[model samples]
Target: MVNSITGLISNIQRYSLHDGPGIRTTVFMMGCPLRCAWCSNPEALSIEKQLMIFDQKCTLCGECLIVEPEAISLDGGLRVDRALIKDIESLAHCCPYDVFEIIGNEMTVDELVDECMKDEPFYRNSGGGVTFCGGDPIVQADFLVEVTKSLKNRGIHVTLDTSGGLPWDQWDKLASAVDLILYDLKLHDEKRHIEYTQAGNSLIFENLDHLAKLGKEIIVRMILVPGVSDDPKDIELRCKRLRQSKANVSLIELLPYHTLGKGKYTRLGMPYPLGRNNEKDKVNVEEIIQIIESIGFKVYYRSP
Candidate 1:
């Protein structure tokens, strides 16, 4: 997709089980400025350099060698070693099969459309389509606009998974191109939001308001984080705010926390804040669904 899409990406998960409606190909983008404490995608936090290792597939052959001090045996589809991968990055520059490779790659809009078009037939049949996911689509707004436009031009359904934290000026270019936006609302309180994500969310709310007014197809998403986002009062407040936003968004998706990305941070030499076994309640999902339904909105159970 580099020749067509103008940005870096790590992987294109084809026929993804969950991400959006149908069997979607979730394009995992790179680089996000936000440092949300509860984020599972540690790999998407930075664009500079990253290291990843699959502990399950490691052979422990002990033939590892890499550029960074922390990196070991991540150069290629090689024999594995029991070495720490933290503090190593130069190792990724020499890989052949993406062993211990970075998650994002650079591509152009034309190039992305060209490459993604390879799966057109599958999308047509499975009610599946392409989903632009990342730290946030707004991080790469320009590329997303062109790519989504191209997809629309060719009669493909386009979905944008974003945090709605971008400036209104940049968003105007993408409004018409995106068919649906899986708008992620992190925290409603300015100070608490800043404290948790290290970034204020006033702009996020403003953008949501604008998008709702525009009457675009929207699905509101909330990460059902345990301590960070699961207070009953907080959920009610969020609900109240949404009731007042008057945005056109009608669907709600509840994404509960999982330990899927903690190992990513370990390979990158970063501490896993949630750590393994930091469990969150699955029971709250019913309550959340009830509340959203009570508000007279349709809700998708998972991240459809």
Candidate 2:
């Protein structure tokens, strides 16, 4: 009976199909432990509220400059020096045209449920419910558990889309709250996992094993990143682990490599670390499907 609980949310996307079984309301929470190079939602990586400067949306009216002219400058185009600002939160109100938009929202569990209840009709018709997603929603496990408990009490199907990088104790708490788990397996080798995702896979594998033993309905998602996670040996090793776990895997999804998040770096004034290798990292969907099917698991493809 947890009544008062609040979580930092990045976005609450409605009618999302690829996240789960049906049309789902994917609640994207802020913060993540691992920093994956190919993260699609870069804004959600940090726990704090961030400001995104969409230059395309700017009219160069210099309304934001009035708030902090020293922090922001207009040369050829508008440029915001985020480093110079002490209190960046105040700048979000300075923009009238939404060129500088804050990307996080703090909402209580009751408030969030009220928002989700608006789409209950859609959920019932499409066999879709609510999905708790990232930047690794498991980072806010306690908040998620409470919110999910409330959702389930209302007879809503809840799904957790996670990277399985959290503690086993947290996973134990979530096992009863969620209806399904959409787990991500990036790399099989521990060293390689650290090299790319900036985290180890030991806890991930351990938690997966524990969840499988509990017989939770799970869907494993593996993103095919060329020269990084797309290695045949890595894929085979991951599949072997899944087979050994004996978890009820509804599907094994192979998401192809894409440059969808490349522009996000420019928006955040950060360098794109993956370079221009997205084109080369692309995988053949049909071939991957066949390979995964041969491993005695149902395979699905989402092209890059």
Candidate 3:
């Protein structure tokens, strides 16, 4: 008997510094348990191949339209007939300017390892390695476990950027393999959590609690949505929870909400429920850092 597993990968970002400790390759996996209104990676929201159109880049070359089993039409831009779509690769490749893009690809453990290893010199030189970010990588625990094992064997550091919404029992081994956990904390209030994230915070809290109890290295990444989760009291409560959880909260990173991925929704022909928070001046990173550090935690801003 043999065990073989392949996971759907959304993208493999190379030479990324913000993802972890040093220069690293960040593997973006598909599928997520929660749909946060402010999610930046709209392409990673679904666990399937999604067509993205950039009309500005389209020269009306008609290359994509000429392909047999024609999946695209030019109605002011490259419009894909979802019902007629067959080979995603075929349609995507037909584009010369790459206006038509495919979001996800399938990769086996060995294949992904090969890709990650290509940047071994960079990782070694910078004390950086590989990070598995998602739509929650925990969804593909088995595949991640195997890939993590391989990376660890090569002395490469591994970081799992997760929402911490899945059952701990399912990926406890994977957690043990990780050098750091980039845990996301959206909202502390349960009702508000569901209202924004389309899910409750119970499981996320439980998983974080258990991981903290295990004394795993964790860095909490909180999204600062203006008027939504920017309350000082709520932030303080969250910090207190982390302090009580006993998790080695090395850093608390406040990520200010951006409308970067909002355009992606338009490209995908989907509704962008998370509109821009125009009151950007309201976000005070220094003050938030003070509140978090008051609870004895270090703080950083994803963007100030």
Best by lDDT: 3
All-Cα superposition RMSD per candidate: 4.7, 1.9, 2.4
Task: State residue 155's C-alpha deviation in candidate 3, in Å.
Answer: 0.4
lDDT of each: 0.71, 0.85, 0.86
Give the runs in model 1 whose Cα sits over 4 Å from its true position: 1-5, 53-90, 93-99, 275-277, 280-283
The model with the greatest TM-score is 2
On lDDT, who's better, 1 or 3? 3
Q: In model 2, what is the error at residue 178, expressed in angstroms?
A: 0.3
What does candidate 1's lDDT look like per residue over 14-46, in tens digits? 887566677777887776757777777888777
lDDT of 3 at 65: 71
| TM-score comparison, 1 vs 2, better candidate | 2
User: Model 2, 1-304: lDDT tens per residue?
Assistant: 5468899999999999989988889999999988898887888999998878888888888887778888888888887788886666778787777777788899988888888888998899999999989898888888888888888889999999999898888657876679999999999999989988999999988888888888899999999887778877778889888888888898998887778778877888777777656567456566667777888999887864
Q: Which residue pairs in model 2 clash with each other?
A: none
Top-down lDDT ranking: 3, 2, 1
Which 10-residue window in model 1 sums to the lowest lDDT? 62-71
Number of backbone collisions per candidate, in order? 24, 0, 0
